[model samples]
Target: MDTATLQHRFQTLLEQHRKIVFKVANTYCRHGEDRRDVSQEICAQLWKAFPDYDEQRAFSTWMYRIALNVAISFVRSNIQRERHAIELDESIDIAIDDSTRVHETDENVRALQAFIEQQDPLHRALLLLYLEERSYRNIAEILGISETNVATKINRLKQRIREHIA
Candidate 1:
């Protein structure tokens, strides 16, 4: 693809699947600075891979593959990046239904985040994507696993999280 075509395609993909970037960043980075860095890295990788995107595959699926791959690789190489504290802000507050509920959910999310931080990079990616409610088929496509394996992994991971929370 030429520059213009690639740019147009990239813009369209960005507009449609921008959440993939945020999701990947949140999964890999604990602090705002690392989140921004990971998001930029995912964007860079996506742009580099855009020309090779096969239209037959779903755009979100293809985007997820690139984003998750970059995020997993980043986390694998930088153990120190995993130690930053994540600050709760107004945005997270907005996600809460009420102050009390917010407090409870915040605690749970924090505990969940701690558990997630301990997982291997690929497991972290799978758990985050599953929590975000990605379909099993999509998860399989992104991870290059079978749908059954995706379902099994999610079930097992959820059980582990539950045990951790308990």
Candidate 2:
């Protein structure tokens, strides 16, 4: 494809799947500036890979793989630098789209997010994708795991949340 065509396609796909960027950033970063930096880095990496993206595949699937990979690497590097300490600013509310999120005041949802955030990074990514209503196959594809593994991990995460809330 020509440069113009590729640019148009990339723009459309990025706009459509932008939430994946935000979700990954939110799951990985604790502060606003850090989340913005992560989100920017994810976008940059996505653009770098755009030429190699196969048009026949689902855009969100491809975007998730890129975004998650970037977020995971960014988080790992930050963890090493910070000596594995994470600071949560509960007062700074992270906005979730109305379609995916319950009322911010809902205690159950708040507790669930808190629990998910506190889990291991991989499990946190799994829970984020699960809560986003991604299918088993999609989650597996995004995480490079088997469908059965995705199911098992999701079930375990759900049970962990329940145990914590109870």
Clashes of each: 0, 0
Poorest stretch of ten by lDDT in candidate 2: 83-92
Residue pairs with backbone atoms closer than 3 Å in model 1 (clashes): none
Candidate 1 per-residue lDDT over residues 1-166, each given as its tens digit: 6899879978988888897788778767766787899899989999888888898999888888888888878776776553643334435432221233343246677777678877887788788778767899888988999999988988899899999999
| TM-score result, candidate 1 | 0.82
TM-score attained by model 2: 0.89
Model 2: per-residue Cα lDDT over 1-166, one tens digit each: 8999888888888988888888888887877788899899999999999999887888898898888888888777777666235554556565678455445466776787678667777888888888779999989988899999999988888788889999
Model 1: lDDT of residue 156: 93
Q: Cα lDDT of all candidates, in order?
A: 0.78, 0.81
The alpha-carbon deviation from the true structure for residue 91 of candidate 1, after best TM-score superposition, in angstroms, is 10
Q: Model 2: how large is the Cα RMSD against the reference?
A: 2.2
